[model samples]
Target: MNIDSITNGVVIDHITAGAGMRLYELLGLGELDCSVAIIKNVQSAKMGKKDIIKIDALIPIDFDVIGYVDPGATVNIIRDEKLVEKRTIDMPELLTGVIKCKNPRCITSVEQELDHVFRLTDRAGKVYRCIYCETKAG
Candidate 1:
């Protein structure tokens, strides 16, 4: 195993490799004006397989969008080669514009002009339903 060191950046760990690009697209990382190091298919002690994203700048997190999609992920803020903050995200019940409804027939999915909208069922339940088509997330 080869672990390269980053001088300064935030490292997102334990992301699913398949979701890596989707994560980037959803987070608007590619559009951002910053150097980003995206590492996928890394060996992990806990996850067995994992992906990591290193951003060479501080980006304020949209926690509501993050928690719902990447609960298994962790964000480690780096400063001068040291980890400044380690944030473990919990599942969020409510979200807006982060994910499209999986159901093809859902209005949000069908209508490119409309933004995806979700309603929180129970904060504790972490359950959300789409507003346009009323598709429940299981």
Candidate 2:
């Protein structure tokens, strides 16, 4: 509960409860050599309970992954212990490399060099379909 404020870093907020670890893994935060904090089930007036991730370093992050995982999440850039920018994550219209095509007949299955791509076809249903095979992503 005594997480220190970062001098310069990114704060991922409003994550759905129990999703902090998945985001951490998906973002490859474990590979970084900087202070990273994952706070889960924190009280939130709007969301009841939410998760937050604070990285104590200014590093590049894949916003697509964040959008896919938690579209409502917010990214706050901190510099000199002050918030410099705030970005609201929204579901990306196109996704590449964030998820893999599971269809066995898909080209990506055989072509190891091919990037698994998907397009948001139904925003209301949060549905995505593979661009190559048209197979719906789970």
Candidate 3:
């Protein structure tokens, strides 16, 4: 309940409830040496229930990964214990290497070196189709 603030780091806020761990795993936060905290199911006036991730270091983050996981989330950059920048995430128009195409016959399956690419085809439905085979991304 008592989480300390970071002096210089990034905070991922307004995460959809129960999505903090998925974001953490996809972002590979566990591999970092800095302190990281994941707060789950925090009551929020706006979101009802949300999650937050605080990283105690300034590290490069792949926004595409965050968008893919939860586009409704926000990113806060803290410097000298003050918020320097606040970013509202949106669904990326294109995603590369963020998600693998589940289609077995896709080119990515045959060519291991090919990066899995998906383009957002339907923003309303949150649909992403593989660029190689036009297969819907799962």
Q: Model 2: per-residue lDDT, tens digit, 12-108?
A: 9999999899899989999999989999999999999999999999999899989888898999999999999999988999999878889999989
TM-score for candidate 3, residues paired by index: 0.96
Ranking by lDDT: 3, 2, 1
CA lDDT, every model vs. true structure? 0.76, 0.93, 0.94
User: Among all windows of ten consecutive residues in candidate 3, which has the lowest summed lDDT?
Assistant: 98-107
Residue 20 error, candidate 3, Å? 1.1
Model 3: pairs clashing at backbone N, Cα or C within 3 Å: none
lDDT (C-alpha) at residue 25 in model 1: 71
Ranked candidates (TM-score, high to low): 3, 2, 1
Candidates 2 and 3, the one with greater TM-score: 3
For each candidate in turn, give its C-alpha RMSD to the true structure in angstroms: 3.5, 1.0, 0.9
- Candidate 1 residue runs with Cα over 4 Å from true position: 1-4, 101-115, 120-127, 136-138
lDDT of 3 by residue, 1-138 (tens): 899989999999999999999999989999999999999999999999999999999999999989888999999999999999999988899999878898887878889999999999998888889999999887
User: Model 3: residues >4 Å from true position, as ranges?
Assistant: none
